[model samples]
Target: MTTDPLHILKTVYGYDAFRGRQAEIVDHVIAGNNAFVLMPTGGGKSLCYQIPALCRPGMGLVVSPLIALMADQVAALRQAGVRAAALNSDLPPEERRDLWRAIGEGTLDLLYAAPETLLRSGIIDRLRNIPLSLIAIDEAHCLSQWGHDFRPHYRQLDALVDLFPDTPRMALTATADAPTRGEIVAHLQIGNDDSFIAGFDRPNIRYAVEEKDNPRRQLMRFLQNHENESGIVYCLSKRKTEETAAWLQDQGYNALAYHGGMDKAAREVNQTRFQREEAVVMVATIAFGMGIDKPDVRFVAHIDLPGSIEAYYQETGRAGRDGLPSEALMLYGADDIALRRRFIDESDAPDTRKRMEQQKLDALLGLTETAQCRRQVLLNYFGDACSPCGNCDTCANPPERFDGTVAAQKVLSCIYRTGERFGQAYVIAVLLGDEDERIARFGHDRISTFGIGKEHDQRTWRSILRQLIAHGFIHVDLAGHGGLSIAEAGRRFLREKPVLMLRTPPPAAKGRKGRAARGGVPVSLDQTDSALFNALRDKRIEIAREQNLPPYVIFHDKTLIEMARTRPANRADMAGISGIGEAKLDRYGEAFLAVIAGHQPDAG
Candidate 1:
């Protein structure tokens, strides 16, 4: 057996070389140094630890927070010819005993355990006796209190450091800003210089944020472009997720609803269906996306605003993980802003945490409202510098901005004149000189700000209001019935009449030119290669069904695309493909070559 990291990477995982910083990370771990790795979701993070586990002497222990994550990783690793297993609640007692025996006998190359399971006295006592090559904490950001996925059990992971002191330890996460990164490092007790931060940019994902107008209609239009592709639609509420899934089903799409509100069996079934089948759309709340290993998700659409930029980044990062072209579209409005603000403000968190949460929201809003390149603004938030990507909505067609000093003063004056206790609809009603009964009862019709904003219609006023909220010129009283209150910045703007540059909301998505609407990410195959790719994919699905595994576990779409493009005629040619390792080649290479040569494999 090869004990070299590079040889293991190629022979087991089937990649010819390390990408970006994987080699540096693997070498550091193999050399017996503690490391912290922050790579993007699809950046091949598993290789950093997986290769080292093969090169090093003993079993690799991975502390995972989710049972599904552990199961998925173990399955994928085992498929890649690594002897991986997980001790989780799903395993029967007999099976657990068998796995324990395997671990004790040193027959497993990698072992994954949920955080709680790892902390069990029986498990730790056994692990202490076994020779350990390394300890890896996946999704290490869950240990940070500042993160959205905080798990109490993750805090207990510090015990692993003492229990396996001689084993090289590493913590890995796909999402973390500077503060969260520091917390993970401190909690793991890794030195600052040992941390590796690969570029967080997922260049394959084309980002598009649109103003919410006729939201269902907007989502429908967006879906038109993504027809027959695997994707996710994230709604803020449980009811919305179900409704969206039902509506999509009514439209002839294979849509499923998944959220915390469902029965455990139902949720698992829906998740399984989405993972195993192609072109299944999962309409879910924020609860649906972590540890999802599906690699060909073509799009991620947000029907509502995420709580923070980090949440947004991580959710969207789930798409295009296989490095194929993908799209992320968010339809946001004033109500989303208000609901998210209320969620943060009404939480039991301390004052400092609330302030931090508010700042993160503001950053997301800034990205949504920016007239500059969306990718540039998004990357800047993570402290990664990049040029205008020309692959986002703004770069494809920049929004027009106008000097809104007069408009801003008018909006602020309207808010101030209305006693600052009214909701957005009422304020817009007053601004538009509408004389409804509520307006009459409140006597807001007589205010000086009444009819002042009539030059721009109601829709225009709503857009301006949402932008103002995003810019921090106004705050929403979500707990108090979604009232709009002017902020200090609004007061200053009103007093000084500073020029406010506001972007005109982009036009509704036309869903034209297919993927071109999504900044032209390459999501399709040409006519000549499309047939072969589909044939290969059909074969992959057939084998996956026979084995009861997700199609991606056999080979990702990118790998299939390479096969179709290259048309490999023999096992050696197939082995040269990116994901076709020696184990895979030995297992199914001849069958694939047979397909390429236009013959069916024997059914025997």
Candidate 2:
């Protein structure tokens, strides 16, 4: 085997060059150093450790969090003709014995195991005798309590440092804020100087957030453009996941549901179908998509707001993992915000942790309410910046803003005079001077603030209230009856009479429209190329079915697009295409080349 990292990259992984700081991180690890890597999803993070492991003498041990993630990575590596295996409870006892035999013989290039398995008494004792090239901890952010997805088992990974004192260790994660990064480094005992902080940016994804007026309709409209494409629809509750999946199926979509509440076998079947099939929509709760390896998910839509910016980033990052054009759509309303806050307040965490969680939620709310470029706000949350991206919803359709101080004051005053115990609908109705028995019974109809808010419509007033909640000027009584009350900031605002600007509620969407009608990102392939692309996908699916693997494990859509356009003619030409390594060239070069050749003009 070649000891050169670049050589292994080209001949084994089939990439012509290293991306970003891959080469630097690989060299540092090869030199027997510890480092932490922070790169976006689909940023080629695996190569940072894989190359060094291949170049070094002993096998690499990767600590993964999920059995499915381990299986997927091992499959992809073996497809590239590398010796990789995963040890988890999913494996049969016979297969486990075989893997251990291979490990004893030093025949494996990489071994993946969960932290719990690695920390087992006899397991660590046995591995201590074997030579280890490096210890890689994937999804390293789980070790940090400050991270969005914290696992107590991951906190025990620090023991690996003392157990393997001489071996290089690398911690890698796709989502981590500044605090989370600090916690991860401190927990893993990695030197501060050894950290490589790659900027967090997934430019291929278009960000869009809509007010949750008609969530089902909004989601349907968003799905129109993604017809016959694979995606994930995230819900906040298990029952919602099942209901949403059923509703989508009624609409003639291949939809499935997944959540922790389902039976274990049912959950696995749904996940397997989602992985193996095309054009399937998986409606799931937050329990899904922690370590999903599917690279062709064209979109991720959230029917409910997530808890924090970190959670939002991690979930949305699952889309567009193949460097292709994808989208992230979120529908949020006052109720979602209130429910999220209630979750935080009701948790058993200390006040400091609750405050931290609240701040994170506030940041997310700010992102949802910002009129600036969504990408800029999102990137800035992670202490990164970028020029205005023309892809997000804000950049495409800039919302109109108006002076809303009087409007805000009217709503706040009404909440106060009405005893601050009514929901938004009743409050808006009172402001609209609706001659209802409930309002007259409470004498809210006579309040001075009631008729004063008649200038703006209910939608406009709702927008103002949402923004006020986001701005910390109002608090939601989620624990009681979802009522609204003025916060300290709102009191100060009424006293000081400061200028306040709020986004005008966007006009109701006219009708159900497809992506083209909504000015969505155009398909990358043209008419002629699309035919060949379709043919290549058919071939890929056929090969995948035969091998009992997901289609992407055969080749990514990006690779197929290149094949269709460039029309590589032979094995050597196919080897030059990205993702086509030497082993794959020998196995699949002719099959793909034939498809391309048949689609040529002269050949027809």
Worst 10 residues of 1 by lDDT: 514-523
Residue 442 of model 2 has an lDDT of 80
lDDT of 1 by residue, 1-604 (tens): 6888888888998989999999999999999999999999999888888888888999999888778777778888888899999988789999989999999899999999888988999878988999999999988888999886788999889887777778899999999988899989998889998999997899899999988988888888777777678999999889989998999999989999999999999999998899899889999998896768888998999989988888999999989989987889998998888788788878999999999998999899998999999888888888787899978888988899988778888888888988888888988888899979998998888889889888888877888999998887888887789888999988877788877899876554555444433212234666556767778888999999999988889988888889878888888789999998888888889878877888222221
Model 2 compared with the native: what TM-score? 0.97
Which residue runs does candidate 2 get wrong by more than 4 Å? 511-514, 517-522
Each prediction's Cα lDDT score? 0.86, 0.90
> TM-scores of the models, in the given order?
0.95, 0.97
- Model 1's TM-score against the true structure: 0.95
Error of 2 at 504 (Å): 1.4
In terms of lDDT, the best-performing candidate is 2
Candidate that would win on TM-score: 2
Can you tell me which runs of candidate 1 are displaced by over 4 Å?
A: 435-443, 479-481, 508-513, 516-522, 599-604
How far does residue 511 in candidate 1 sit from its true spot (Å)? Answer: 5.1
